[model samples]
Target chain A: MLNIKNLKVSVENKLILNDLNLKINPGEVHAIMGPNGSGKSTLANVLSGKKGYEIQGEILFDELNINDISVEERAQKGIFLAFQYPVEIPGVNTNVFLRTSLNSIRKSKGEKELDTLTFLKLIKEKAKELGIDEKFLSRQLNVGFSGGEKKKNEILQMKLLQPKLSILDETDSGLDIDALKIVADGVNSYKKKDNAFLIITHYQRLLDYIKPDFIHVLSKGKIVKTGSAELALELEKSGYKNL
Target chain B: MKNQNLNINQEYKYGFTTDIESIKAPKGLSEESIKFISNIKKEPSWMLDWRLKAFKRLKTLKEPNWQKPKYPKIDYQDLYYYSAPKSSSNKPKSLDEIDPKIIETYKKLGIPLVEQQRLNGIAVDAVFDSVSVATTFKEELTKKGIIFCSISEAIQKHPELVKKYIGSVIPLSDHYFATLNSAVFTDGSFVYIPPNTRCPMELSTYFRINASETGQFERTLIIADKGSYVSYLEGCTAPMRDENQLHAANVELIALDDAEIKYSTVQNWYPGDKDGVGGIYNFVTKRGICKGKNSKISWTQVETGSAITWKYPSCILQGDNSVGEFYSIAITNNHQKADTGTKMIHLGKNTKSKIISKGISAGFADNTYRGLVDINEKATNSRNYTQCDSLLMGNKCGAHTVPYIKNKNSTSTIEHEATTTKINEEQLYYCNQRGLDQEEAVSLIVNGFCKEVLQQLPMEFAVEAQKLVAISLEGSVG
Candidate 1:
């Protein structure tokens, strides 16, 4: 339930994404694979409503144009972007941040907010499923976390927020094999008929875990090729040069 | 997205001036003004003489200019030194007799001046302008042998304690502002805890400056007797004025043998406007001494307001095995200027001290941390640890750290650490992407940075201080 038409993005007058178009329906998974300098990450950033970018064209979620929405509003409207590198916010406890984020979205959606005890109970169950220590939630947010832990934490947030449209921007880059499987399992279990995912990556390894319904190759800021799950394995063998 | 509305009234919520008739002393800083103050308070001859002595020294003490901020010379002859609400001419013997308007003013400020509406366990002394209008839970405090009263009342009733402890820590000729405060100081809180006793409740003083062109000079004294313990809190606010106002206060604390004194301050004076045209010039002197063996003293402050803030809450470790600690969080935004820190002096053997300071600068403000640690020759085996951290929101603001450490004994050890960091844009974006606005994100990150210092405050004050930290940084982000 997401649509992008002729989306052109630039920063500091340098074009990053050029004439990009994509669409994802409910219950579907789409993968965009590209080589270095291809606009895969740019597409993710543009969709999340980041500032300081010169953007053109339109992006629609559920037939509602969201190009003019703020970042927080976009998040409240069920748009989630998993960053390539999570930030280390010292002094902010992970649990508190999670609660604040959850309650803010809940308030915007006119839903009942969870109290501390209720939130703790829900978070504990989710953390256990993802193999996260309870102690990490009490510490500073991602201050000294390892690479794998950060990716796991990202997935935990994804599961917690339960956003309708999840954009995974290089989520599998720093994860080990076990961690990658845990992330894939977390996403696979949450995949519902009303939710969609846009997976952006460089390798075919992650696709082996969570198969995509369709795959598109992005080259020099445009989509150059489209195929099914087989395209990822083919590109991994032949590389983008022969695409 | 909905249009974000910026409410200007919420910026300085305490900027409303109370409209009331006031009786003011003749404008000027002279022997006559000091005498007028002493006469109105009806002080004893000895107390008047003490004030006169401080006035004599103030004449020769030129205002110090070593601070980072430089302001226009204050015209002492053109400013009123004392202004009190006319309704307080005859002190109220009961809460019912107090002026209704004065009580209403305190009510609007969220202070419970009446006994029926008291804040559960904390005893408050509400000082309006130059006079203390009401002190809550006085009789209850007296039941536990805790002497909590206005300094004016202390001079008349408990002269012995006042005469002995007054100027004992800071002295009359300490410096420019302290000396001036000693000379014409009209009213503040005084507290005393008897030996072998822990105070039953927190003692707090709320100072409000409601008169225009009148300098607020308050003197606070607190003493913890042998083996006794006490905690005191002080808060200040003023109306938004177009002309700069002066607030020079002196606070002294003494801890006797095995005694401990914890003092905390939440200074939220008016910081002028965004253009920095007017605000309070808060120059204060606060010092505590660990006088007897094994005594301890600690200072905690959250400074968020004032056009220019210049204060150093210090401690002198004079007893063997005594300890001293300073925890401070100073925030300057929207053209505000602050130069604050603490000093720890070790004079006894095995004395120890620790300091933690966090300074946040936003808009075009400037924040500085100036601290000193001195270990005397006799203080063998003494140790000191210090940490200073600064956070800046934008490139237009500035933060500075200046630390001076001196150790005369070879056996003493001193450790110091300092860091300066700009607010991480990525962190803000992360929080924003998770559903928080820019302001909320900034507040979350800032509160985390000041967590160490905010923890030192009492539970009730800690919550308020956290909110104040957020409000101080409102509209700071671009």
Candidate 2:
């Protein structure tokens, strides 16, 4: 349900994503493995419609061009990007943000809004499943949250939003093994036949739990190779130098 | 949730006047006018003498020019010194006896003085025009040996207390407004909590200016004796008029050893029409003194209305281990101009102070957050943290921050931070993408902007203030 055709993007007049191309269909998980400067996170940001980007190519979501949509509109269109570095908003509680985002998406879909009690129940259940402490819901979003906790919060938002397309940008970074498993499990539990994911990572470890239907090697903002899940193992055995 | 069902044709809900005609001096400020006011109030000879001295100072004291927005020089002589609606033929013995129009005005304002006493368990000293109309729950407070009444009544009942503490912190010559207020001030609330006595209820003063040309100059003094505690609330509103009204008032608080005083003000004076033609020029001077050791004082204000507002409720922390705090949320909409903040002076050892101010400027309005925190040499180990945040709604409006910090003690720690930002487009887009309108998104973001200060208000006032913030920003977005 996502397509990119020779997408060339630049930020602040500096070319970040050169001629990049990728595609993913529903019910499929795609992983993009790249070195530090391969423009992996930049690609994720451009897809989420973050401001200050110069794009020369087309990006399509469900057959609609989405390069001009706002961040929130992208969210309503069922496109979620878990940030590598979460933004900290003091005095804005996590639960409030999640509920607001969920209700916002629901409203855009012409769905009924959930009352406070119902929203609380849903959040409580999802938070527990994600092993998120109840107190974290009342604290300001990402304020003073540890690295792992912020990543887990991103997953929690994804589960509650239940977006059709999820883009994870190095969600496993800074997380311990246990936190990595919890975060992966949260993403795994939200997987559905009608939804898709574009997971970006530097290591092959996350692929152990979240198996990818297709693997693409990205270098210098271009996809150099495309293969099956086994291609992740090959990359792990030999670094990008051998590619 | 009392909704104000306003009649479409009503000039303004609080615009109604009492039939009890007031004895007013001719509009103008002269030595004669000052003397007329003091004589009309039947002040003590010494007080009249004090008024004369203040009149002299008023002449020499130039009108402050540093505040935002410029206006014609105040035609002191052209403004009525005192104006009150004629009193009821028979003074209202209770809430029911008061004028129905007056009661309705309070109801529309959500103060429901009588209902608040019966349902919400709050005591209200409702001041209409220049006179104290009714003070509810006085008997219960008197039983606790607390003196809560009009300043006029206090002078007669508790002369010693009023005589000793009035103008102790804010002298008559402290500022031009203070001098003006000192000379013509007619009536305001006076509270004296005796030593070791905790006030039984939250004392509130609601000042409403009803007369057309009458300028409201009321003075409030609250004294919390040793080991005593009291929380006082001040609120004001005026009738909408084409001619701008002047409201210059003085408030003084004194906290003795181990005493604590909490003062809150929600000033919603008629802010004129959207074009800012005629609204109350609210220039007030309010300060508190921590006299004895361990005394604490806090000033919390939500200033949402006024054509031009220049007020700074401050505190002087004198005694050892004393504390002072100022929390405020000032919103300026349309053509309103507000330059308000606070001053905290720490004089004793281990004293602490905090100032949190939020200014929201919308339309063509200008809002400024100005504050000062000074730590004296004797105030070792003193600490202060000040955070001032301003939000601009449109490009036409302005938000400015001016903070002055003076620390003389080596052991003191003072941190001041300020940030000015326009409402985030991303945040708004995010909210709208979810289906909420732009106004709702702006309200949510603005509410979050002032959340730190709003949380400091009493629960009931917090909700009201939050709603006011949204309403004030209603037409701000394009």
Candidate 3:
């Protein structure tokens, strides 16, 4: 469902992702494990259509090249990037922003927009499933929220958006064990036969929950190795140095 | 304003000038011009004398240069001091008697001149150019003992009241602009709430400058009698003109014993063009006095237009246990300059005051907050708190804060806090990634920064002010 061919990403002439190529088919979870400076987040950003980068090659989702699409259009086209560091917007209520975003997508898709009451009901159910209260939704988006709460909120958005391609960039980095379980459960619930996920991480811990179908070791902007789910455990014992 | 990704530098939609027949005085600032304006209004001998005295003082009172703005020398002789709508010559006894053309002008300006009979709960006094065209809900307010009428009408009908309170708070010799406005002021609103009564509805006045080359000088005086309460709103707009127009107006509020007055203003004067070719030079002096024991006054303003703005809405707490509050949101975009804040003087024992200001600068514009808080020796146990925050959209813009505080009494307490922040790129990207364009993202972040001050505005004005904040920052960044 997602394809990248000879994708080269650079910022200010400094290459971050060099000749990277990866593909994830429907219903398959691909995990990219890399250490610092390994271009894991760069790959996530490049796929999400972020600016300020000199990118070469092509990215295709569902056979449609999305390199020229804007970030907002990419979002409407079902491309979701779970940021490593969520942005904090003070004064904007989280619930209002979320509803507007959802309605924007719904409008473009020619679907009936949900009224405020209906939107509230849907968000409340989703929030309860993720252990979020109405009070949290009323606060400014991510302003003064804890690390775990931010991660949970990200997953909540992912579940609501129901994007076809989800790129989880370091989603498990700062999460505690309980938060990790909640996030994994949220992602797992959104998993469908037609949807795909590219989970990028620095540790093998998250693989124990989401259980990737394929594991790849990314080094110096390229995937150096590919293996099965057991590879995560192997790396946890042997480390990437012996890969 | 729709496509956030598109660079914001859009043309001002309200820039179109309306063609109205006007009787104008010759371009100049002199006793002759002042006399001409007063003669047009057919003022009494005392009113005419008042203008002549103010004009004499205006020649000696030089414009204050302590502000942070830099503008070219204003040729006072090049501006027409009086421009009155010709239709105003025949005073309309009722709404139906008003000229259709003048009513059409107000309709296009989004000001509903004809009362719709619905409980909109607002009494509008529409002032076009130098004359008040219509005042709605006058009879209803009269039943409540609320004297709501044009200052010109007040002078003719209630001469005793007008004579007693005119220039009481800000004397004619107060400042340069105030003196000039005093000498050539045309038409404005005068409100009075009787003792032990509350105004049934919000009193509003829409001030519009229609004719080009005509400077708008308005005077607003609101007096809340003992144990009375009233809320007043003022809005201003001028047709787009290439030459810089001056709006030097004065507003005075008198809160008598145990009375409260809440005043709000939404200033949307033409901010010139995108290149800042021409706009209004809004230099206004607004001051309120808490005269009686336990009286209170509050000032809320959303300033988003004009090429240059110099305003300081102030309060003097003379009544024991009185309170004063000032909430402002000043935005400068596209080469606009603004130096605005508030002044609070504590003279009564246990008096209290609070100030909250938010300034936004974008597109090479400059915004500054200049505030003052003074506690007299007799104001024992008084308290004052001030918070000033600034937000910048692009690299070329600037924001500044200058706060002057003095406490003569050891028992008084004063606190001031200031912060400056930029519209974060990460936050914009995050919102963009979530399906909002750059414009929406910027608007969201900016509105967040100004939430405190926006909350102080009335519910209806709050929504419009939020949209104004977004529009003011449109295409500010390349």
Candidate 4:
């Protein structure tokens, strides 16, 4: 469902990522593990079409080149990136933002949008699944939410969008045990045969819940080694020195 | 790159002129010019005397240079004091007899003058150039003992009421532009709500400056009697002109004992071309006085046009326990200059006032909020709260806030808060990633910034005001 070959990214005269290649087919969950400054976040940002980057080479998703597509266009074409740090947009209600985002994608797909009542019901059921019961949908988007709550909100957006390829960028970094469990449950329920997931993280705690078919260690903007789920646990015990 | 992103390219939408014959007063402002305006209105001798007295007082006053917005040399002698459509020479007794071309002009401007097609429960008095052409729902208003008509007609038909309150709130020697308006004012609306009665419908007036080489001086006076309540709204839009036109208007509102008066205005005069060559110079003076105990007065305005604007709608809280409030949203884009705010002078014991102002400056425009809160010595236990916020877009624009506070009585409290923020690229990127284009993203952010002031506007106008806020800040996102 997603492929990247010879991806090079730079920002403001500084080269961050160089000669990166990866491939993930349908129904596959791939984990990209890397240390700090290893181009993990840069790859996520480049995939989401964040500006201020000097990019070169091919970034194909679903057999379509996404290097030149705008951020919203990529999202409309079933590509979603859950940010490590969600931007706080005050005065925009959470529910309103989610509804607009989903409806925009639905409209591009030639599907009818849910009205106010239907949207409210859908959002409530989704929130109930995420264990968010306290009227957080009406508040401004991530204005003053706690760390765990913000991560849960990201998962909520991913569930609603139902993207073909979802990039979870450090989704388990700031979460507690309860929040981590709920997030894993939410992701596990949404996993299907025609969809794929790219989990970017540094720890093996998240790997215990959502198992990946293959794990790749990213070092100096290139994959140094590829293995199975045991690779994550081994890296957790012995660190990156052996890789 | 930033300059290209911040260049606003929206052309003036209401720039066409209607070809209508106009009866114009001779150029210049002298005793004779004032007399010419009064004679054209066919006023009584006392009204003529009032204008001559105002003109005599105006000679001693100089053009006010105290405002922040700069004004070029105004050629008073070259300005025509009065110009009305020639079709209304006989004063068209009915709306049907009025010129269809004039009605069509208003229809094109999005203001329906015909009562049946109008926004139900609201009346409109349209002023074309310098004279009031038609006032809708006149019969319905009069049946409730509410007198709403042209100020000129009030002088001829209801002389006693007009004479009693003509200069009651704002005297002839109030200021420079007000003195000019009092001397040569042509037409405006006059409203009087009877004692112990609430006005049934929302009263409104639409002012248009169509004729060129003319000055529009409107004088509106509203009086809410004892135990009465009234909500009045006024909206103005002007056609494009090559030379700058002067609009010096005077509005006075009086609330008696146990009465409440709400005055709202949405002003959209032409703001010149992108380079600021031709537009309106809006110098207006609006004041309301609470004369009796327990009376209230409120002023809400959204000003989005004019090359230079200098206005301060104020309230004098004279009666004990009286309250005053002011909410304003002002936007200046592409060389437009606006210096607007309000004043609350507390002269009564236990009186309270609150003010909220939002100013947005984009392009090379300059926007300032200058407000005054004065608590008199005898105003024991009085209170006032003021909040002024300015939002700037792009590096070329500017926003400033200057607040004056005075509390003579030891027991009184005056609190003031001011903040200035720029529309950063971070906010825009966040919105853009959410599937909104630059224009829609800027509009959404600006609307959120001005939500406090927009909430104070009436429902019908709130929608239009939100759209105006978006359209005004079109390319200010560098």
Candidate 5:
């Protein structure tokens, strides 16, 4: 469902992602483990079509070269990226933003839009499953939210959008153990046979719950090794020094 | 893309005028013309004497040079002082009896005088040129002890009240335009709310300029007695003309002890074309005075259309514990220029004032926010806060702020903050990424910029103003 061939990306004349290649199919979960300055976040940003990036090489999504598509178009094509730091959009209620984003995606997919009642019901159900307080949805998006709460919000957006390819960039960085479990469980619950995920992390603890099907080691803007779920544990035991 | 062509002639919507013969004074400003206007209205001797005094004062007063607009020297002697459509000797008893041409002019301006089911509840006093056509809801307001009528009628029916407070707040020699307005002004709305009486409905006055080569000089006065409250709204529009037209109006308000007066203006004069060919020169003076303890006064304006607008609606906080506020959103697009703001004078102890101004400049337009906050020596513990922000859409346009804060009292506190920013390229990119076109993105960002001031309007007007902001910014983006 996703393919990156020798993806080279630069921002402001600084090469951030150089000759990076990766691939993932439907119904599979892949974890990319890298240390600081390993271009993990840069790869995620390039895939989401963020501006100020100069790219060379091809990025194909479902057999279409999507390097020129806008971020919103990528989102409508079932591509979601949970930000490392969620932006605070004051005066825009979370529920309204979610509903707008949801309806926008649905309209792009030629699906009927949900009215207020059905939208509320859907939000309530997702809030219950994610253990999120219902009141948070009515407040401004990401405003005054704690680190863990913002991570949970990203997961909430993923659940509502139901993107086919979800990329979690450093989603578990600042979360406590209990928060990690809640966020990991939120991701685990959304696993389906027709969707894929690329989970990027520096710690092996989140992998204990998510259980990736394949593991790739990234360093210096390139994938150095490809292994299975056990590879995350090996890195935890020996650290990236041995790799 | 198909909707782009629909707005090609959008500026021409207000370009047509009704064809009617008018009784016009010879083009010029002189003592004779002022006397002619007073005699035509059949004013009392004292009124004529007052007009003569104002006419002399206007001669010595030089045209103001503080506003941020440039134009050919105004030929005061080249303008017709009084131009009114000839009507029957008897006043029209109902809307149907009014001339159809007058009604059609109002209809084109979206303010039809002929009452429809939707307009049954709204009280409208439609003013054309120098006379009031019809005043609806007069009986209802009269039952509530409210006197809402034309200034000419008020001069005859309630001369004592008019004499007591005609130029009490803004004197005849306040400014060049005010002096000119005092000299040859024909008619406008006169509202008087008795003590402790709350007006039952909103009072509105619509001004339209129709005659060619005629300058509209109207005067509006509103007085809220002690412990009374009232809200007044004013709107203006004019047909397009190849030559620039002059409009100089003066509006004054007086609020006594514990009285509150809310005045709002939505000025949409005919802004010139893209090349800045011909439009209206809107120069006006509006001021309110808090004369008694604990009085409150606020001025809110949304200025979207004008070729060159030079006005500053101000307030004077004279009584102890009085409050004054000014909330303004001024947009200048396509060769429009606006130099507008407010003045708050703190004279009494513990008085407070606030000013929030938002200016948007686009399409080679120049918009300026010039304001003053003065605290007198006797105003102990007085406080003032001002926030002025400007947003520039394109590089060719200009936005500037000139604030003067003068405090004579050591115990008074005044805070002034101003910011000039261009539209966020990233925010625009984000909205465009979400499938909104460039114009929609610009509108959304502009709305967010003016959100602080727009929220101060009444609920229904807030919505309408938001839509107006969008319409004004249409085609502004390249």
Candidate 6:
């Protein structure tokens, strides 16, 4: 679903991601395990079309170059990035944000947008599955929310938008075991043959709940090793230093 | 790049003018001019004398310069004090007799004066230029013993009520702009709710300034009798002009024993071109008095237009247990400037007041909130709460808050909270990443910021105000 060819990223004369090449097909789950300062988050940000990054090489989504596309266009084109630290937007209700985001994507896809009542019903079911309270959706987006709640809210948005390529950037860092399972369940249920997942994490704990098709170890802005799901368990015992 | 983004190209939608003959008083302000206006309205001798007294006081008062915005000097002698549509000379007794051209003007402005096309459950008084041409649903209002008519008509028919309440809340010689309004004011709405009765519908007045080089000085007075209730709204718009136009208005509201009054304003006068070539200078005085026990008065305003605005809609809590509230959202974009807030004066014991103000500044504009909360010695146990928040869009714009508080009684409490926050870049990116464009993201964020004040507006107007808030901040994002 997503193709990167020697993607290099730099900010203010400092190189973050150097000569990174990766490819993921439909129905595939790829996990990038890296140590601190290995530029895992930078790869996630660059894929989301964040500004202030001097990029080199090419990014292709379904064989179309999206290097010039804006952040919103990328989102509308079914590219979703779950932030490590979700922004706390004061005063914007979570439900309203989700509806607006969903409608925007729908409009771009030449589909009829859902009305308020229909949207509420759909979002309610999605929130229930993610173990989120209905009251949280009515409150300001992520404002004064617990770490677990914020992560769950991000997953709720990912499910609502139904993006083809979902990027999870350390989404399980602050989640408890129970919350982690709910989040994994949310992803497991939504996985389809036409969609894909790119999970970037420092720990292999989340991989226990949701197994990945392939695990890649990234070191110093380069992928050093690639293996099956058993590689996560082996790395968890031996660590990235021995890779 | 930021300057290019801030260069807004949206046209002022209500800047069109209608071509029609007008009977204008010669340009100048003098005793003769006041006499000319009074003669045109055919006022009683006592009313004329009172206007002359105000005129006499206006001559001795100089314009106040305490506001933050400073403009070029205004020559009172160069502005046409009164300009009315010539067809309105012979007042129409019914809709058919009124001039079709005048009615067409209001129709184009989205305010249908015709009987069948009138707005449902809302009575409107359409003021074109310097005269009130029509007031809808008059008969139905009269059935409930509610008096709703133009000030000119009220002076001629309900002289007793007009005489008893005129200048009661706002004295004739209170200040410069107010004194000027009292002297040369042409026409505005006047409402009176009878004792023990509630106004059945919303009463509104739409003011339009179609004549160039003319000043619109309108006076509005609303009185809610003992145990009565009323909600009144005022909206104003002016055609685009190359030379700056002046609009100085005075509004007074009074609530008697156990009565309540809710006043709202959506002022959308022309705010000049983006480069600040021309626009309206809006200087208005609005004050309400809670004159008896348990009375209440609330003021809600959404001010988005005007080159420079200076107004403070205040409340005088004179009755024990009375309540006062002020909810305002003031937006200034381009080269516009606004200095607005409210005043809460506690005079009786156990009174309470609340103020919520939201100011937004975009482009090269400047927005300020200046308020006063005074608790007198006799106002024991009285309390006041004020929250003022300002949102700035770009570095070129400015937002300031100046609050003055005076508490005399030991038991009285005053709580004030002020915050100034800039639009965060991360927030915008987050919204964008959720599929909302830049403009939509800004609008959503701003609407949420002003939600508290927007909820205070009537349902019909809240939606319009919300859209205006977004439109006012257009092109402000970089």
lDDT (Cα, tens digit) per residue for candidate 6, span B29-48: 98898899999999999999
The whole-model C-alpha lDDT of candidate 3 against the native structure comes to 0.89
DockQ leader:
1
Which segments of model 4 are wrong by more than 4 Å? A95-131, A192-195, B1-8
Error of 2 at A210 (Å): 1.2
Q: How close is candidate 5 to the true structure, as a TM-score?
A: 0.87
Error of 1 at A140 (Å): 0.9
TM-score of chain A for the candidates in order shown: 0.98, 0.97, 0.98, 0.97, 0.98, 0.98
For B1-478, candidate 4 gives per-residue lDDT tens digits of 1212233677666777889999998889988888888888889999999998899899999988888888789999999999999998667788898899999998888777876686577888889988899988899888999998989889999999899998888899988889999999999999999999999888999999999889999999999999999999998888888699999999999999999999999888999988898999999999999888899999999999899988999999999999999999999999999999999999999999999999999999999999999999999999999999899988898999989888899999999999999886766666655555567668877887787788887787888888888888787764
**Which tens-of-lDDT digit does each residue in B1-478 have in candidate 3?**
1343565566665666667688888779888888887777778879989989998888888988989987788888988888877877666789987878888877876777876742577888988888898999999999988999988888788888888888988999999999988899988999999999999788999998888778889999899999999989888888888889889899999999999999999999999887888899999999999999999999999999899999999999999999999999999998899999999999999999999999999988999999999999999999999999999888898999999999999999999999999888788779878887777777878888889888888786788889888888877655
Q: What DockQ does every candidate get?
A: 0.67, 0.17, 0.56, 0.36, 0.19, 0.58
Which of the predicted structures, 1 or 4, would earn the higher TM-score when compared with the native?
1
Candidate 6 docks with a DockQ of: 0.58
lDDT of 2 at A121: 98
Better of 2 and 3 by TM-score: 3
Q: Clash pairs of candidate 6? A: none
Q: State the lDDT of candidate 5 residue by residue for B139-158, as single tens digits.
A: 88898788988787788788
Q: Single out the weakest 10-residue window by summed lDDT for candidate 5 chain B.
A: B1-10
> What DockQ was computed for model 2?
0.17
Chain A TM-score for candidate 3 is 0.98
Which is the better candidate, 2 or 3, if ranked by lDDT? 3
Q: What fraction of the genuine interface contacts, i.e. the true contacts, does candidate 5 reproduce?
A: 0.06
